[model samples]
Target: MTSQDERRAFWEERLAADWTETGVGYRALGRSFNEWMYRVRREVFLDRVGALDVDWTRARVLDVGSGTGFYVRAWQQLGAASITGSDLTEAAVARLRDHFPALRFERLDVAEPGDTFAGADFDAVSCMDVLFHITDDDRYTAAVESVARLVRPGGYFVFSENFLHRPAQRGVNQVNRPIGWITARLDRAGFDVVHRSPFLVLMNAQVDAGTLWRKAWGGVLRAATLTEPTGWLAGAALYPLERRLVRSRTESPTTEIMICRRR
Candidate 1:
């Protein structure tokens, strides 16, 4: 199989085994930390998107790479008129259907050709933390094009991506791309960036490797890895600090939420 095929198979198998934290690679950080991280990231994503001044009650929403459908629930709570979640994995789609029977769910691979949603478009498309995993140049371009097509003209596409330009390997995949490269692709795909904000500024994989406190905490967590419940407490304590630091930064962050408008 090709590298892209290998990556797709990897995610399918991984999500099939554990659709929650493992699907997103949060399991290693402990349970509490994982939950806390998810909550904070969701909040940041919504906050950035909210600044766009879109009317959620009248919006048709599409969430690409929906995973376990956390954002699907968020949009529901926000009173979106319609919400559809698409995932590449059968396990994620099944769990999403079971958890949210009222919403539409589809099995989609953004890197592939053709319309996975039957030429249907939406007012907003949320493709959070998914594009970076499309590591190959051709596949990444195709995925961006596919996602852009799913958004109506003048609609929004909100996504989270790692802006760290350095070469690094995360898990079984070596998936890091520069911020300029991503924006250029999106621009070609008929999208213009509107707003961007950082999430997890202070505590991240890079920082955890070098920082003393982070290393020490990581060591403690590693020692008591089974006590997943307490991980959130540590995350809770770290949240405010991260938020404040991120807000103070002016440069590009390791990861950021970008709000793009389709032209």
Candidate 2:
């Protein structure tokens, strides 16, 4: 098992460099890795909630740990009035602004004091794929509290992390599960749970099974040469298999979306 300091430095170093460029075999292959994964995660997430209308027009969104500004760009494309992306990595914020010149991006670590973009400046907030990086238990609490402070009442805040069936399955998810226990924290911070999508959360017991399985699946299909009908048939068959695999906590932790509104 990795020590807390080691794990913390893993992310600290990973973020110190630009990583949004990692190649992915997602739907938008020609686009950047972060962009493609953003679409995949967002679409799959919203599909669970049966929502197609995101209502992002004229909305101000603050994206925490906004590596590559994936979702920020997604919302901006949907006509959001403004999007502010904050990250610990200066390179990340720089690249995001450089690529999407129209949007606003800044460098800030909510965990650190005196960091800009600290509070009450957004109508929406999204913290994705970074909750596990917070090794300090209290830091997680602080992060959520700061997010709540930054959003207006009735505004939306979305954050996600994986969970195991039991604490014993901890190694399977690699990242931690304060996210699961924080349901009370969300309510305590005056947020109402509008929706929770428990998908990509089935693969436990296997080492990072959710993330690995997803990437392997993508890589396998990346070289596909099938026709539309063939691909559709394959998808129909594949989806059920995936469902069977993920239906049990013994299997996966691909992803999950929890949506809450500041009350």
Candidate 3:
């Protein structure tokens, strides 16, 4: 089978086995650290998206890669008129259906042709920590274009990525594509990136930095997080500092969120 097809199968089996919030996040960091990271994401999301002053109470929202329905809950808290959650795995869609029987959940593969809902149906689309996992170059490009098509003209697309400063960094299931290339892709897709800010500076993987000190620090944290108690303690200690960094820093060594509007 093709590598891209293998990626789809891998995600299907992976989430089918451990379909928890931590399972969709950095599982090696344990549940506490993942929970802390989600907390940080919540605050950052509210702060940034809320500042837009949009009438979310009347807006329809679509959340891509709705792992564990985290963003679905966020949109609901914003009082969106309606929200539909989509994921690349049946396991996620099935579990989300069970969790939120009132809401709609669908299986979607953004990079694949003929795998979308009615076009331009959403006022906003949230694809947090998801695009980087489309490790294939052609597929990544297609995903961006697909996202563009999914949003109405003048709608918003909010996503997060490492946005590496140097050349792209590739892993088994992720790629930290350069910020320049990503922006260019967005531009080609007819979207304007209005704002971007650090989502997590020190609490997550520092794939962009490629520094020895950063690697060593990451190693220490990963090792300490092997146990639940130590993981909670480590996350607690880092939570405050991480929040401060996310609030104060305009850029980050790890992940950052970008607010884009279709033009």
Could you tell me which 10 consecutive residues in candidate 2 have the lowest summed lDDT? Answer: 23-32
- Give the number of the best model, judged by TM-score: 3
lDDT of each: 0.75, 0.58, 0.88
lDDT of 2 by residue, 133-204 (tens): 565556667777878888887788877666444342344214556445667667777888876554443221
Worst 10 residues of 1 by lDDT: 202-211
Clashing pairs in 2: 120-150, 200-254, 200-255, 202-252, 203-251, 203-252, 203-253, 204-251, 204-252
Clash totals in order = 4, 9, 0
Report model 1's TM-score to 2 decimal places: 0.87
TM-scores of the models, in the order given: 0.87, 0.68, 0.96
Per-residue accuracy of model 3 over 49-144 as CA lDDT, tens digit each? 888858999998899999888889999888889999999888899999999999998889888737458654789999999999988878888889
Query: How close is each model in CA RMSD to the real structure?
Result: 3.0, 6.8, 1.4
Q: In candidate 3, which residue pairs get closer than 3 Å at backbone N, Cα or C atoms, i.e. clash?
A: none
Candidate 3 matches the true fold with a TM-score of 0.96
Model 2 residue 4 lDDT?
45
